[model samples]
Target: MDVVKYLQRAGYTTVQKSFYAKIAEWESWYIGNVRKFHRYRIYNGKSYVSCRRLGMGMAKKLSEDIADLLLNEKVQITIQDSSTHEFVTQVLNDNNFWVMGNDYQERKAYTGTVAYIPYLDAVRVSENGEIVDGGTVRINYVSAEDIYPLSWSNGYISECAFVFYKTVETKLYAQIQIHKLQNDQYVIENHVVECTNGAGREVPSEKWKDLKDFSGLSEWVETGASERQFVVDRLNIVNNYSKDNPMGIAIFANSIDILQGLDTIYDSYINEFVLGKKRIFVAPELLYTDPLGNPAFDPNDVTFYQLPEDTLKDGGKPITEIDMNLRADAHEKGINDNLNFLSVKCGFGQNHYRFDNGSVQTATQIISENSDMFRALKKHEIVLQSVLEELIRIIARLGQKMNIPTDPDSKMVIDFDDSIIEDKQAERSTDRTDMSMGILRHEEYRAKWYGETLEEARKNLPEQNQVIE
Candidate 1:
């Protein structure tokens, strides 16, 4: 199908004309530069000018223009091999090009939340060979923190965050900075603690002051993990921290995993509570028999049984250490992703994965067959939820302290090392994985609005908030 004709059916006229004009110029420019028989598109029996007569600059410029026009909003190009199910979608924007839908599935649906920001200046690929018009590129920020307690509780429960973490890029400025290096469960053995030795006077930022020896030294552990990172960075560099210990004040540097892990726990808790089967919705006759044959017997369903109120358990050590350790390992997949990027910047890092099969599987098996194990699991879950809440609170405080006075609406530019910027820009770009942006945005709004409304409602209801006084 003619690209313009196909796009014309989809709509847009001026956009099509612009592309045709550019395509003609490209054919002519190529003929003049390459001194070859210029093959041109036959439209109304017209021979387009050959580009062989034109200079190399004109040909090269035309080539760029042709590439740009391919992505112009007017040309909705769909490229697919007769042999393959994959098709790539590219859309040209005012200043960038975006390609998406290079996944297992041949088709991809974009609701709007999906922004295909290129990793700076790299080309995006598609299952189909053609580039869609008005393709916008995406930019990915290498982050240090995307999860919490990388070595410990890698999840959160019963939590609601009113923050804009979803669309907000994980770049340094866009990210929530934890500069204070607060202590979490995983302790770093070597850390740098500071204290003014002379007069306990606070030092101002702009002024240069005479410094004596410092106090408040703390121990933090700096493992040479980054030295063993897997891949290379855009700078053609690898993580190379060979030191057995990096300087630090805490046992471990508060990592991105802590925040991300907290979110997981919160989400998991909410899922078990809110996504359970509804007794009222279940038909009385079919409730006893379902086709999937795996309807969870939810205790919360009043119609199912006269379920007793959940009782609090006595404080005891977590018995599911093996399971917990495995869970932490399994959750580190994303954590390791950011770590890999960081390793390229600072040095290499020893990667860890959240183990999913062994202990977690065993615990699930035991809890499924034995009621006692189930109760213990429930108790552990409750404790885990409580612990996660405390962690969030601590992080929140650290976040507050870390917040520096800066414009919330500031446009920040990340400067890469000029030596490697060219190569980095040439690397392959990644497409945003999120597609159902509308639903996710809606969910985000609902969560935000729901939390605010609930908070306001509670403020007005002394009966609910009386404990505050």
Candidate 2:
């Protein structure tokens, strides 16, 4: 067995440094200063080392035997290719170091760089670093809730995300389940959380604010769509100014059949802030309508299909077009009407029309349809902000028209041209409204009186005077 050539085959550049380390009795500098592998301590020691002997046959069994002896002998050896480190480590795992096999793994090696020759020996790194391998749990899915320390924003339902990114193909279905505590009986609740705030953020006005087992747990398969995608904590939506709230979230798997069944689902507590409540698990799609419609895309007319096409489809009915359109149109109309109302209330540079009561009657008229009006600017802040810009524009126009003083910090409101209104009564869409002020201000505008005013207004008429007699 040529140690020098073996090192060369292992791709070790410094042949003497690698080979001499093997035969040295004690940890000697020539052999003691072996090399570095990320997790394992590297040193060279002589073995009945295999060079190019078993010719073309890489016996995994021989590597296993060598690994056992190294562990018993407590000698360190370096293999050239790190690619086979897993195989060698498996032998070590089988012989000794029977703690958890997959975690805090000392198997970190560059794919093409160093490899484990036979097996190397080293003591467990630390009391804290010592892992009770707990043998191995062929975990179909691991819920991080029990182990990982989780923190999430309060007030909103949070989702617990579970990311399973493995090479082997597996199909596993996972859903979060919550049991509400009531009358000492735990009732299972499903589809409790809502994806409010348009996107999947804060909770809606649906759930109690202080429910226990608050959802902030997110669960899902590791699709690699959005990075930082891992299933570490529970999820829920909270207000913009919420503090951290803790709760329990449970994970359930469909079946344990697949070779790589990493249960993947994004989940949340419907309402965590509610006190004395059972945990509620929910599937997002269960309570959802596809943003546009169809759950999965159809090759035919897949306009509103689900993205990626891999997600299992769930369907519930949506409202009729009439209902949906009615609501949406109502919202749109509400915005426009509110603006109109604001314009009239602010006088729009017109002499404010007042009833005998001295209160503007038009203001009342503006709000008459408030019930049906969409609150485009309903929230105090939202409305004020929207009107601020339009208000400035209106003030500028009014100053030009009536020489009116514009309030600097006002929500600008101005009158609409008459012709722009509906014609139910007299069709006011013309430049002159049903009011007389706009007409009076026009230079070429003529006034037509109804009865006596016509004669009076025309009294200066030179030609028509004889007809009046």
Candidate 3:
């Protein structure tokens, strides 16, 4: 769908549409539909060619790996207020935030940008436009192609439009939700239009009944909150494609050539077995037809071929075997080399991945803090941390608007998983040694190891003079 056309038709400003074309290209690569070249072959002095669309599916693999490293079930997000934390957790669980959040990270890794928009669902507004009762906050995940930056500053998108496509009875429609700032308050505008022939035209709201009843939605909403209700998350890479572009570029955007090379090598490796199969040339006189006109030999056996009459005129043998040498080792080495290059170019460092047994395997050894992979993970966490914190705050605000007991200003603590980069058992051993030597306090060690506050650890400590070893 031409989302930009719909955004423009809805009177919303948008970034250059050309950038989304690049997003589509990246999406194609992620899905392994890239067509780099074609293959031609000569059989029986006749030349034939066909398009070759092969890939290693490395784009998606890299993105998924990044997502797993960045945000997993082990990662903890806690709010200072216990009740607030429980409420928020329930809300996130109801929406499957952890799973969908990882998916958002993966999409952001490949498409360069993803958004989280929180809205109040099933709410009632009083005559004074105040939310009276019965509303729940819900999140809408948006990828780059559907995200339209209306206004941004210094890479922060303050005003934006998100396009959502819906199909009803084979007819397509676009709903453009625009978040803009007016009178220091964030105002949301909704537009539903018909998407036809690459253009968008106005449509009546009654055409889509769910638009109003689904979320207590309206054509215009004036949220009393000052902050934008949406959060845009992207990789930490500087966008070199367009200096003025706020959208992020894919993590492997600069390594597309390496990806293509890897796919080419892998494709060649797979074809080696097909082209190097054993073949037998048989003289036509030796292979007679049956009474029913069927060949004496199994016709399904493609390895056997009839030799030309001229070939047998020089006293050639009745049957000759031809076996082409397979370059399996050479092809494997080429593919491994390309995979190493791809790993490094995508910031995973050298030897992070290996191609083995027709599959890609990631190294499982713990990475040191000084390694490139460690640094890259930390760098990405910077942006992700902010994105998640902002999303939480927005959720809290929406919860407050719904009269749910929540503290929008509560302190949020996000503990990302670092077990892959740090040796937890060794660290714990060292801490134990330090505590025995009086270098580290017992409460401090307990708090650090057990994921607790200092006061809580101190309160739960054993008697000072009692050694219960």
Candidate 4:
């Protein structure tokens, strides 16, 4: 989709479309639809070439694994206010944020950036035309290719536009939502243009008549709040693609060559089995013939082939079995070596992935706190933590607008899943020992292990007499 052109037509200026086009390239690799290569082979003394797709699919796996590591069901987001926390939890559950949120993370990992936009749904109005309720907050997850920065400074995107598509029957339309700062307040503009080609290309000015004035939505909305209603999340990496670019590059963007190498090695390993199967060559006289004189062998036996009649006369064996050597060991080693290189390049420590016995296995060993994977996870969580906090704040603000008695200023705490990197059991044992040695306080231990605030842990501590029991 030519999102930039269409957005411009909607009166919203944005970054060049080529930036998003680059994101599309990363998306292709993430889905394993990389550039096709020609495979040449010789059959019947004639050379043939065929286009083949790389079947490793490691790029998708890398994104999925990193996303899972960053955000999973085990991760928790806490809001201090009971009412606001309950409301946000209910909203997240309603939206299946646990599942879809991880998917969004995967998209963010591969596409470099993603946005979470909170919009009200099923709004209610009073007799005086005042909003009685701001309605439920629904989230729209936009990936990199659809995100256009309208205004940004110092690597921060202050105003942006998100492009979405809706298809009515067979006709497609582009829904451009622009979030811009007007008079220090965020204003949202919505425009819908008919995509005559169904590809979101720029529609000619003469064809503006086909544009929808409004997509069953308000033409523009003054959010009444200074803060944005959307949260942008991205991997913690420098945008080497463009130093001034506000967007981030994919986690594996710097390691595309390694990814291609991994796929190439894996493809070769797979093909080895197909091309190295044993074969039996039988002399022509030893082969049976059907009624029509067609050479015949056991129908179920595909490994045998009839050889030329002059084979035996030329001092060749009448029947012979050719067992070609399969370099399974060598191929496995090559794949594993490349996987290690890829793992290190993508921020997972070396040996994080292993290809053994035709199966891929993730390293299950506990990672030290100082390990690269741990540091990378923490770096990523820095951005995600703020994103989740902002999303909660948006939900709270929307609830307040609806007169839902929400505290938008409530403090939020995000606890990311670290079980994959930390050895929880061992850490708990160490903490226990520290507590016994007077190096750690009991309340601190409880606060850490019970996922409670220090005040809560101190208040909930048992009395001295009760501890005797």
Return the top candidate by TM-score.
Answer: 3
Sort order, TM-score high to low: 3, 4, 1, 2
By the TM-score metric, which is better: model 2 or model 3?
3
Runs of candidate 2 with Cα error greater than 4 angstroms are: 1-151, 154-174, 177-220, 227-469
Question: Which stretches of model 1 miss by more than 4 angstroms?
Answer: 1-369, 404-469
Superposed Cα RMSD, model 2? 38.9
Segments in model 3 whose C-alpha atoms lie over 4 Å from true places: 6-12, 35-48, 126-130, 197-199, 206-216, 289-299, 309-311, 435-447, 453-469
Clashes of 4: 1
Q: lDDT of all predictions, in order shown?
A: 0.24, 0.24, 0.83, 0.81
Cα deviation at 7, candidate 4, in Å, is 3.1
Clashes (N, CA, C under 3 Å) per candidate: 81, 76, 0, 1
In the range 296-386, model 3's lDDT, one tens digit per residue, is: 7887889899988766788899899999999999988998999888888888999988988888898988887439998899999999999
Reference-based lDDT, residue 80, model 1: 20
Residues 199-297, model 1: lDDT tens digits: 222233222122221121122222112111111011111112211111111101122233234334433433444445343333233334357775555
Give one digit per residue, the lDDT tens place, for model 4 in 266-384.
Answer: 77887888889899989887787778987567847889987887998999998899898999999899889988988988889889899987888988778764388888889989988
Task: Compute the lDDT for candidate 3.
Answer: 0.83
Best by lDDT: 3
| Superior by lDDT: candidate 2 or candidate 3 | 3
